[model samples]
Target: MTPAIPLVLLGLLDAAFSGFRAYAGSDARIRKQRFATRAGLRGLAVGAALLLAPTLTAALLLVTGDQARTYNTLAAGGLGYLLPLTVYATAVLLSLAAYFALPFRASTLAVVVGLGPLTLLRPLAIAAACLGAVLNGGGGSALLVGTIAGAAVLCVEPTVHRRWYHHVQ
Candidate 1:
């Protein structure tokens, strides 16, 4: 089992990057300069995370040592960890693409932004990534539970956002 410290740190970094990207993308037109910087930083952060994933996982394994069951599970074990990383990476790319395309596709961006708030998406991504970490300690069932929970959140997020935004507007 990896120590809680590294996992918490990783989660914090993930959440920060995710939050930046979602916020920048959502308001790129209003703040192009800030959006560009944020996008660049987010790209760098995601790249570094992917590059160091193996090393970090190895280090966690070393720190934890090969003990009982679920040793080295999160980092080196299965698709559980990798899947969330991939999802996050893909989301970053897609969000950037959408931001870039927003000017040419205002309707599309509007529809998307109208459907759900970008703010919520950021934390959802973080939650998914943390669930991936849970795979390290808990196992496949943890990943499954995370997936289900995430799906539930995703399903309900838009309605909550829409209602809130409607009132604000």
Candidate 2:
């Protein structure tokens, strides 16, 4: 499968985790049980919204000519290499958005916290992608992807956090 699919799914899972947490807060489980379905569905929506840029970027890249690409077949310096960087950038942007908008809603906070596992691995993912691309004799495209991905992932989080609060509230 394409690497993009997994990244987007990870985004979905992260959001779903947060959604469940939002509903199951400091209350009885039975009380919040009814909201489970709604929460899960909404989580998917939120995940889509949050990862829309990267997901769409991946789709666009694939449609343009990278359709045959898979993680295993990702050629360095090719358009396919951009997917990881884009995912990384999207995540960074979200984080930056949140950092700048501190003291957000607890639910939004929960979403941020819930992404802990994926967030932790993002750096490694990007590093490996970039390093592998370079070692594979990649050139401008790979470098460009890394630069932009680094910029975006480092930038989006805080922005999304601030904006997402308005939605959750």
Candidate 3:
């Protein structure tokens, strides 16, 4: 419960980035055809995926290990959250680099600017979300749960995009 907000934020970021990528990568013809309808479909699919993500993630984590049951003080959490934090920091740096490259690619900025960097950020975002959940939930077990949940969430946008792109059109 304590980690709920962080997890929600992570899910939101996943959907947003995914949606952006899909839209940018789509065919121009498709983008121009009933654009609003396609966008709405994408939104609905991503929303449904977001709701389903946590349940599947929780089930997978719960059945997989005993380590997922252990709680610890932040001090006791030790290296569990460390690696994730480091990865998240690296992602932030890379994302910054991508943003800096914006001016150079200004022409295509609207279409492809955020695609690679955002895709690259997915795993790192999961790591960051997991660490936040572990600390907030006061348990190392939350680390595993967070990891699975964040990973599950990462698929939301892409899955939605694929589904809607085919069906909505």
Candidate 4:
């Protein structure tokens, strides 16, 4: 199967989980319990890893090129590569921590704290970058699928959060 398949499946699963949480009508506290399980952590890890793969690969290319002098993929003399790598790497690490390391409610809160502001900006930019990559034959379908998945998450999460928090207060 293509690499995009996993990303697509995970994206769909992510959306499904968000939808489940929305319809489940559980309070934020209880919802955190549901989402912070071992299984849920694994899912979050996988999804986060997938989401960051393309940008990481790009950064790795830059590192490898510097070490081996084989090729440099960091277009625009590294400016293009550095920006996305730095931003995405930071976001991914925090997202992993928020979902995997932190406790349930705190994890949910952590994502809000970390990503709430950049929710629209980051996902949209990444989606646009991925589309550009696909059109320019830069990354691949997997990266495109991942960007789409990330965008889907950004779009749906606020509603999920609202649903989760609705009964809390």
lDDT of 1 by residue, 1-169 (tens): 4343343444434434443444443442654776555544554444344434434544454466554443445433334544565666566556656766678577467546633354446556646665655655556533543344334323332332342222432
Q: What is the TM-score of each predicted model, taking all chains together?
A: 0.39, 0.40, 0.51, 0.35
Return the candidate ranking by lDDT, descending. Answer: 3, 2, 4, 1
State residue 133's C-alpha deviation in candidate 1, in Å: 4.3
Give the poorly placed runs of model 3, Cα more than 4 Å off.
Answer: 1-3, 30-37, 40-44, 53-115, 131-140, 166-169
- Model 4 segments more than 4 A misplaced: 20-32, 35-90, 98-113, 138-169
The residue-by-residue lDDT of candidate 4 on 39-148, one tens digit each, is: 33444444455446545654465465554341222232222322453465467557757777889998888767765554435555555545544443334433433354
Error of 1 at 60 (Å): 5.8
| Whole-structure CA lDDT of model 1 | 0.47
**True-structure RMSD, every candidate:** 9.5, 10.1, 6.6, 10.3
What is the clash count of model 1?
0
Top-lDDT candidate index: 3
Q: After superposition, how far is residue 10 of candidate 2 from its true place, in Å?
A: 2.6
* Comparison by lDDT, 2 against 4, better one: 2
Residue-by-residue lDDT tens digits, candidate 3, 9-124: 54555455456555654555744646644654575457556656555654454566454354233223324444454466455446556666656566356225444555666676
**Residue range with the least summed lDDT across 10 consecutive positions in model 1:** 160-169
**lDDT, model 2, position 114:** 42
For model 3 the local lDDT of residue 27 reads: 56
TM-score, candidate 2, is 0.40
Reference-based lDDT, residue 133, model 1? 52
